[model samples]
Target: MLLKKSLNIVMFLFILHFIIPTTTGYTHSTLEKTHPVDREKVTESPSTIELWFEDPVVLHADSITLLANNGSKIELNQTNVDAGDKTHIITSIPEELPSGKYKVNINVIALDGFVIQEKIGFEVIKEKATQKKEEKLKIVKYSPDDGEIVTGSPQKLNLWFNQPAEITAIGLFDNLQQPIFLSEPMVNTEDPNHIIVEIGEELSKGTYQVTWYAHPVGADINEPDILDVFYFAVDEFTPIQQLNKGEPTNPFWFKSAGLKQLGYWVVFIGISLLFGGTFLVSIIARQSDSKKWFRITSILLLVVIIGEAIILILQKQELENLSLRQFLSVKFVWIPILQIVLITFGLIYSKIRLFFFGVTLLLIPFITGHASYPRYGGYLTILVSALHLFAASIWIGGLFGLITLPKKEEMKEWLNDVIPKYSRWALISTTVLIATGIFMTYSYIPSFSTGSFVKSEWGKAILIKSVLTLMVIILGYLQRKTIKRLTSKAFSTIIRRSRVEMIYGLLILLFASLLVVSTPSAAEQGVYPISKQDQDRELNVNFSPLYPGLNVLTMEFGTKDIEKVEVTLSMPPNYNVTYNAFKVKDNVFKITGNLLHAAGTMAMQVKVIETNGEAEVFDYRIVIPGEMRLNE
Candidate 1:
């Protein structure tokens, strides 16, 4: 019993000590990616300028500006959010721009109510007067539109152009770059500018791409043909699946998270021992000596109070990117710090009042957690969370007190009485836990759809925690059955099962930690659009599932035996994350993670180091999708 209890306490403190410096921090909305890209050069003027962000941005009249090289503001159409992809804010150029360097400046409010300002610059190359005049020859419309996900295969491919154009060549391809048969292009009967081609065979359930070459009907033969490409999916399988190839994103939370969960676990266990032991002693086992256990519980509470202070300080420092001294100066930071100090004094000076007043301090986590900022039932959720915490502490702490009881012959009589009384309390606590758990789940999740529960990180965490809780309940049931027998053998069995139950309890706390950090599905409205692709003659880069969570990035270098590859990804002003890509096969390198912070736009820089120590750098700007409306 001594060894088992000591090990549990050591494990609790060990996790608390390590995670004190890295609890979940503040979440500020940020830019994800942008169109035109920063410092890009294009051969022709773009029809529209677009921006993507990790969170929704509030748009206004002066939200966007197009400034020429000499600081002249170019007129633009009224900016609006993209209906299909809420995270995208777009505005038209109205008229074609002349060849020059231009800057797009934007100022918008992020979801977290912070004003974000950013500038994207690109150069437009001058085209010949004749070529500019012939720009009307471009394709105006197409079937299975670019990046569209369709239900089934269509019979023929169609294209519409603003000007009469002769199709030179047409090709179709699947995700694997395998060619699909296409009939020779023929002109539509009603419109000379429209071209049509029959599909040689029915398409399968996968993403498909169409490439066509065309030129103006009455143009010079020496002029180059116009090349165009578009993609559509037969079903839901998108290009993101191609890049990831069914591999799960790197589990960052499992790798380096759960600090807060462990911190709370320690606090929960500490309070449970202090108060649960009191309940057991005063009500169930008044004649049994428990001073030694009470002493351990008092010392553990002191440690927990100190740990809470350290976690608060570290969390504030990381959230604002501030130094310890700078964080200390923040007035609001002191409120929690002072609260903790008073809780410590209460623990030391007055045990009776401490049981009531100091215990209330533990409820602070419930107040600051999801309850405080729920999407619905705000105050009701907070109250439910408090009840949930109170019940859980009693159940877990009471179990601990039972398992650590002295097992001498004289103590057997006391054990028999104590076990039955504690069992009743455990049953009541467990019932409250289940009811509150269901209420909180309904309070947080907007929808109960299978997709809503299975798709989001927040949903997954809740599911895992629920499963663990069920397991603990099963163990409790067995222990309850064994208590009715009340033999020495049954007592040993109950004690052993109780230890396993506590371990499960700890795991439940860990998933609870994950839930605290994960954004609820209702909150993350970012949509998965087409994969962002950038390539040159020598290198190709693909970033997929361009939302905030679980992303896969692939890089292919043409025929190079690369020694190493490193990528630095950033969203200007605030967010930056770097990862080293591992060679998946040959010259193809891959890195996957919850890399993109939010839905918007992101800039990525890749450095490829050759075997001879020579390095080549590549840059790309990509967009991610999020909720359309301004976040509350």
Candidate 2:
């Protein structure tokens, strides 16, 4: 009883060691903010307001609005965030923002769900109208080159504005007057005035107009300038056609490709062993007396070498359309060929030297070139992968070979000898397999901790692979242990356990497929800004259908700019609404319309977008649980 208890403790410790090592240093969110600032104080009527952040913040021009002291909101239609400096500079601050104490309110959101609301109050002093408008105010250029051919499939449309115009007010329009959807235009930080717009995907052939409006910093809240428009065209051209017609059909043999490749390797290896075994039996049969096993083995080796050469030729042809010479050049092919040549000489001429020469030739390519780079984890990976392949070939290919061969005492003796040799190699191979697998997981996947593994797709996949690998290791151990206790009855047990090990190995291979498909962890994708503050002053809300649910929905008033924002849904009693709050980006909160479960058009109300615990109210109504959709 004591022994059994000790064994259980040992097993538990082993399991704990395996599980604990794989669960370290994981994080759920990859986003991180780089810069911190108390606030911004503006002194002059600067053309743009620049705020710096430690990491990149997603800037949506339509979502940004500047509020003046007179209770008026200035719309910043197009704002571009500088990619290089981690700064957001509003282009074209409203020219009419009259001298007054003004607050810059910004609602910024990052791609990874971080929201930021930044409020920087600056004083805009009144300037005398008598002072001639400074020539430093560069002219806004809005003309494309004359005679430039507009192609229907042009990759992008270029807009050159004179002087650096604050880019926050530029918008592109399609032929139908609808806004053309485009990702934020990238500006040359070195030349802050130059901006390039990249068209998304393919554009239809037609004329497109890009308009610019000016939103100067500290400008009067009521006044905004409408800048000139630029036009470009995509001329008619030959339509690109698909090379292949019809809906895509899956390859008929796709499912069988892996099985077919495996079968080919098995058959090729089996033939070599078959001829070798036959030759051995023939020599043994000829022996009238003495333990003539050695002579039979020697003959079998020669026959096997010849069979291997034939198999090599067939394998080469099956791989691709290659010249016989080129196929022979491949190291895997050449190794067998050299082995055959040397072994043939050894058998006919009684020259053991040739066998050694062949072995040397086989080791050449395995040691050089890209295969030996230490930074790539070097010789270790090669050794592990080779061992894995070899063990697989022996266990899978050898079994098939044994079942197909004719029964003979010499053949049986050879099989028994090879199995014992293979079992020892299998143990080493399994060790290498586990070690290399762990190295790869830690190297490629980030933080294997419980949090990361649960939150990230890549980590989850690696966790699954690790679990499967452990199962394979356990099965392999059982097989090895069963071999030590071998008896007449143990043969069936060993075979069954070996089969289980093979199945586990296959599962590991399947996990490999999934690992390749998953995205890299957050650390690899680089850091972005994330906000933790609950109240953000720069909350902005836009609802569709103008009115929602029966409740008097009021968009309460609050600061125009904030780092993060949250909205609370409030409704009169007897009405039920279910809502989901999503941080769309760094400073964007998308409070979805509530779904009313009750039968009546329930009156639902939401206070104004809240920033930093402050709120503004905007009231609207809709039929409860109506089919109306709201897009922000």
Candidate 3:
């Protein structure tokens, strides 16, 4: 009883040690960096104030507001992220921003869902008429001789401005009747006025527009400013030939798949031989051999199954689409079930049947998953999953078998019998694992090159996993050879080798965990595709309820054209309604009203009528909980 309690405690500690939380601190590396935009002095009557960071930041445009010394709030026309680097650029100025001290209050949320608040103050000085007259207009020049057709897509579109223009906007679009939006453009630091728009992928032969617009420093427009546009064409273009094929962009993560496959096979085959041999040896010994060997094999198999189950569960969670149902539906599941059934029948009846049944059952999952896929034109997924399960069972289960076997001569005969039988199975399993791994690498990542593998995150991860797998294989070889000796002196050495292999197995597990979290390649985050969505219309409105009401409401909308809009706020039966409409912009409107004695869920109706007499109505409900914060 004491020994059992002690063993339980050790198992509990192992579980606790493996389950640490993975949250870490966020550092302000990009935000704190000094850039050219930051070094510019606070100019009197500056056209635009730009903030730059080292990395791209997720900004909440709605939350950002600029407050002046006066009561008036500055209106922002546009907020855009610079594609070249980590820069947030806001364009447009207040209609009549008077010369005074102004504060820019920026509340931004990053990509990782962390909120950051920043406030900066700058002085706006009154400019003399002479200073405005002295300001010179900047001219820009485009490379490729403006009309030259290159053989292949140019890496960059170079633009040279006569003078440094405060580049308000710049982007490229494919020349389709409808505009094909390009990825966000990044600014080139090599040349300030000269910007390089990077074309990361191959471009088809077509005419393209290289549009650029910039506002001169210290320029304020009473009317709308004119934007500059340029056109370029790519004809007879050829794509770059890929040098490194079948290499993962991030080697570390990519190689992990292979390493895991190798490790699983080694462990699976090792365990199978050990137990099968032991059972055979036990039966051949005197009937009074006590059948202690069979009990040991059962316990070892259980331990291995449990350990493998934990690893598989963790993996299933990490790989987005992987599921237990999917895994169980495959051939691997059948193999184990068969093995268990065969072992049960053998234990109850004949030892020879037990050996044959166990061997056949063990081979099913591996062969079905690995061999029957392409060559046999069977269910590929089932085959792969079966292979995975077989490898894990053998490797992990085999170690348990080695550790628990008794040192008696009867046990030696069992070991000798099990070891040779397993060797044949192990060799077959290892070969199948390697072949499948190679096939997967080629099929999944055609663009994988040697350079990409070394340089990219995925490649590096795959390399790490591969190295670990090799170590596991080496340890496996040693364990297999040592167990075959079956002498008293050899027992201790074999036990130690098995322990070392187990350590390597655990390390492989850790690498698998890391591989799952990282981006699959330099260009992509594992399986997640990167894309951008454009907003057609945006509206923001804030309203305070006049009555002792449960909820306060706000509504806002903005579009390209102006149209008539109607808003209604429903009040309680006893309360009177007063509505006022205020024009924020030509197309923007705000309605403010109060609801007296409003309770529960309040319904609000909004209607908009365009010039064509088409009306759109929207209904909204605001729920007020029992508790109310009067201060808010």
Model 1 TM-score on a 0 to 1 scale = 0.52
Superposed on all Cα atoms, the candidates' RMSDs to the truth, in angstroms, are 16.3, 24.1, 23.1
Cα-based TM-score, every candidate: 0.52, 0.30, 0.35
Per-residue CA lDDT of candidate 2, range 1-632, in tens? Answer: 43344347545533533343221112111122211121323335556555544334445443245677886876544666665554444445666566776666655543221234445455665564445554333334433321122644655545544555455566665555557666676666777656666667676765455666643434456855635444454562121122333642433211212322232223233322323222222322222222343354355455445545444544544434446665666554665556555544544443243333334333422421112223224467446534433434334333332223324544444334544554665566556656665665554332323543444444555567678767766766776676665554655565555555544444444344333223333212111112333134333334322222211112223443433323333232212332323333434433322222221122334443344666543333322211111110
The superposed Cα distance between candidate 1 and the true structure at residue 603, in angstroms, equals 24
C-alpha lDDT (0 to 100) for residue 5 of candidate 1: 74
lDDT, model 1, position 245: 46
**Candidate 1: residue 382 lDDT (0-100):** 72
Q: What is the lDDT of residue 56 in candidate 3?
A: 44
Report RMSD for candidate 3.
Answer: 23.1
Best lDDT goes to which candidate? 1
| Candidate 3 global CA lDDT score | 0.45
lDDT of 3 by residue, 517-573 (tens): 232323111111112211222444343432233223344565535365555654332
Per-candidate Cα lDDT values, in order, are 0.65, 0.41, 0.45
